[model samples]
Target: MSDNLAIRKIIHIDMDAFYASVEQRDNPELKGKPVAVGGSRSRGVVAAASYEARKFGIRSAMPSVTAFRKCPDIIFVKPRFEVYKEVSQIIRNIFFEYTDLVEPLSLDEAYLDVTNNKIGLPSATLIAEEIRKKIFDSTALTCSAGISINKFLAKTASDINKPNGMKLIKPEEAMAFIETLKVKDFFGVGKVTAEKMKRMGIHTGLDLKNKSLGFMTKNFGKSGSFYYNISRGIDDRPVNPNRIRKSVSIENTYDNDLSDISHIETELEKLSESLETRLAKNKIQGKTINIKIKYADFEQVTRSKTSQYWLSKSTDYQPLWKEILLDERLVQKPIRLLGLGLSNLNTEEKENQGLQLTLEF
Candidate 1:
């Protein structure tokens, strides 16, 4: 490692099953029991699953119905965002006391660069321990911490021990630690990319490191270079504290594939309402509306329309959803999923006399 890299101390903090844990903490009866937060037993998706639920293959983003099938006795709890948000703020406040270079990934996870910190702690490991302890002390919740030179290694280390565990990857051990890492375990290497890597005879970080940079770029395009650098444990991405949200959206998968236009319309209405709720909560509106449809065969299509001005009303989006659905060539196909989104974000408000007419073919 270079001198600059050696001196950098990065830490990744992830709360242990945040939503479910919060529910369990607030309700003493739920302790040590399988719990899921968000969605219901009948429809929608699992937002988060407790570690207890994970034993039966339950996970976030899995359909709630599927989660039910996996763990018949699993308890489902509706999300309490107000409570989650408050806990998140408490955690964030703890992080800010350690370093200003805190980049939050979500309500439960964040990256903190402590090369230079407020408390003048020399060891990043100690800083991580202190932060984790402070989080528990403040919220009565546990978090996992990873200490390393960069975000990737720190994040990977955090997962090594989970649910109130901490792990560190020292500079001297970084190379060896990376060598044994499977390609699938690398950040940003999804199932599709892992399959592609396997087909290319790259199975481990060592295999990736052995390939020429040119060979990687030729095969994987922009991501090839990323893979190459990470295999050697070199990631220079900074902890950006000022990331902005460019869009807000909501999506759902039904218990049965929706076939008729009427059913699809009903689903769209629900999706639109959900999207509006999210937008209103975020206090944002957008000029663009996007509709996503997934067929029963897994084929998906997205259609979008950008208005001249930002719109926050569900009334403005409902007609556009109908237009997109009617205009789609695959309208006759059974729809398995529906999604609605808003982009081209605008925070400024314009006085609306009523719904302004703006639609183009």
Candidate 2:
């Protein structure tokens, strides 16, 4: 690797159960109790779970009813997006004080490039600690940070000591650390991929490193090459602050299953309007429309159609939404959730404009 690549300083910061922690911080009564942030426990999914709730095996995205079964006394609180967004800005402001090369993965996590920082700091570890301390001072919430030479290692290292902690993977130690890592811990390698790799006797990073680049590419295509490089502690991808949003989606889970066509249509219109607002807010249009339906029995189905031209109008989705909603198999069952999404996004130079604002540091 070139000296420039080997010397880059990247940091990944992740909040500690952001939503649930905010709820606990604001309401003293909720502290020390298992808290799940979302809608009613009867009809929604857990958006976030506090450390206390996680002790009971509760997790984000688990069905609320299932969570209730796991912890009968688990408290469910509705999400306050407005509040969360405000805090997100606060932390982002703090990040900008150090470097303009900050990339947000979500409201709860972001990556920072501080090789050349505003503070003239030589140690990325100190910058990470100061950021964490400032976040606590500003919001009374703790965050974990990982420091490394690239985004992948920084992200993976951030998880090593989570919930108010920090870890640094120096360039010298990167290889040995990655070598002992399990295949499942590799970024972008999900459950099915890990299982497949295991079947091929690739259970650890060492095992993956043993495979020739040609062998991995032959088996996994483009991603195979990525796996080969990252296994050897080599990742050159930049921390792109101008990353584009690939898709926009919104979904709602109803308290009561909708059995009537009229009710379903009304809900679809509301969802369509919401999707339009989101599209306009992001200043982008999409070439594909996808509709998702989850039945009361929890069986979900999705149908999609692509348009030759990009669309920004909400009404453009009505026809396709109606067609998918009225599918014979779907109409036969009571619907518990309805989702509308747009993909193959078309952006008008906004991402490029973001690039123009970049600083070398």
Candidate 3:
């Protein structure tokens, strides 16, 4: 590996079972036991499961009732999001001390692009170790970090070692490392997609890499291109700061599976209506409509289509249903979750005036 390429240092940090761990950490009595954080409402879902609980078939977003059934002794704690946010900020402060190129995926996970440094550290590995030490010293929390020449491999490396650990993937070793990875270990490949690939005999990263981009694109569309690149441990995307979000979305899990198209469409309509209200609230404009669907079997599919019109107008997303057409295919499988988002961002407007808009993705 060329020493010059080392300048492109990236690190991905993820706190271990964040919500559940937080609960356990604050309440010493709960440590080393099966713990899950969420609510007991009929349709409530688990926000996080402790490592102990996870070993017993529990996981985040699993039905609360199912979680209880899986581990009857599971201690359920309500989520304290405000506290989590505070902790997240403390960790974020630590990242900014090293580099401003931090992209937070959630309260407990982030990608720090340390291509350049504030502390003049020569090795990203040293910075990662120091960050872990600071996080633990300050908040009594442990975070794992993955370091590499690019975002994809860096994120993958972070998971290689867990809970107060770090892993480094040199540029030359990235491709070989990814070649041995399971297809399921890939970022974009979820349960449903992984099963689809498995049935196609694409079990490993090398297997996925062997497929022609055209074939993968035909199957997965735009995400196919992402898969093609990441399969070879290549990710050129920058760690963008203050990126404009052109869309906002919310989703709720249902106690009952939506076997009927009417129910699924009803949920979509509600999500779309809420999204439109959010758009108006933010005074943002976007011309793309996106729908995310999760099947009862836990397979997810996202379909989006852009338009020449902005989201400020009602006519923009009304007809998007006619374009993507995944609803027609989802008729056979019951939907467990559904969400809607708008993108193809335009610059923000502070006032309540609507403008004719055109957005390109």
Candidate 4:
């Protein structure tokens, strides 16, 4: 490890079932129930599941019907995004009180670099505890926190003790902790990758660490170096406050696949309108209009067209959507999902957003 690693402090704070927790906090009747915040329709998906709901295997992004099947009495609540955003801002304000180097992963989670905090705190663990207490006092919401030398380790540590708990991985203990860590628990290693690693006898961080750099590179390409480094507890990524938004998109999966061209086109138009509203709300414009189609057989394809001028209105992309949908291959199969997105955004330009790292004792 480098000398800089020993001097840095990072914290990952994740709200406990944020959406459902908010609903439960607002309604007394939902306090201890298996509450899922989302639509209850057959095509609906769970945006978040309370801890009670999680016991029944309910999880975010799960199909509502499947969640219902898992737990017949699960209460489904509609999401109040405005309320969530308001609360998120309040939490972010609390984070800013400690450090401006806060990187929000979502409305429910963020990373904080507090090696040099506003109040001149010496321990990252205490700061995490104070933040969690303030969050509970303000929002009646519990959050879990992880403290470590780097973002990846801190993120992993946060999950160790969940639902209003905190865990710290000291600089010296990082390697030992990671050595025994499950491969699946490593950040960025998905189910498919975990299965592949298991097949290759890489079930733990130590197993991954045992592989030669050249061998890992040969198998996993560029990502092999990332895996190798992180296995040994080396993550140099800074806590970026001004993380850029890569794209703006809207997508929907229908309960029933649409075979008719007219129906598909109508849905596409609706998506385009929704995308326009979102883009207008965010004040984002892009030169590339992209469409994604997923067939009933699970095959997916994406098509994109780059325009000379920036596009933000529905009318601007409706023609491109029609042109993209005109393909015979798309019409041959019934589509289960339709998505529209804009990329190469106006905010993609480079800027001086570097962090001002300091070590204040």
- The estimated TM-scores of all candidates read 0.84, 0.93, 0.73, 0.91
Best prediction by lDDT: 4
- Put down candidate 4 lDDT per residue, 179-213, tens digits, no spaces: 99999999888899899899999999999999989
The lDDT-based order of candidates, best leading, equals 4, 2, 1, 3
lDDT of 2 by residue, 164-216 (tens): 99999888888888899999998879999899999999999999999999999
RMSD of 2: 3.2
Question: What is the TM-score (0 to 1) of candidate 3?
Answer: 0.73
- lDDT score of residue 271 within candidate 2: 93
Q: Which ten contiguous residues of candidate 3 have the minimum total lDDT? A: 352-361
RMSD (Å) per prediction:
9.4, 3.2, 8.4, 2.6
The CA lDDT at 81 in model 4 is 92
- The better candidate by TM-score, 1 or 3, is 1
Which 10-residue span in candidate 2 carries the lowest summed lDDT? 352-361
When summed lDDT is taken over every stretch of 10 residues in candidate 1, the lowest stretch is: 352-361
RMSD of 4: 2.6
Q: Give the residue spans of candidate 2 off by over 4 A.
A: 1-4, 348-361
Tell me the tens digit of each residue's lDDT in model 3 across 185-280: 987789999999999899999999999999999998898988888886667677765655656676766767788766776777777777778788
Model 4 spans > 4 angstroms off: 3-6, 253-257, 294-302, 331-337, 349-361
Cα error, residue 37 of model 3, in Å, equals 1.3
Give the Cα lDDT of each candidate. Answer: 0.85, 0.87, 0.79, 0.88
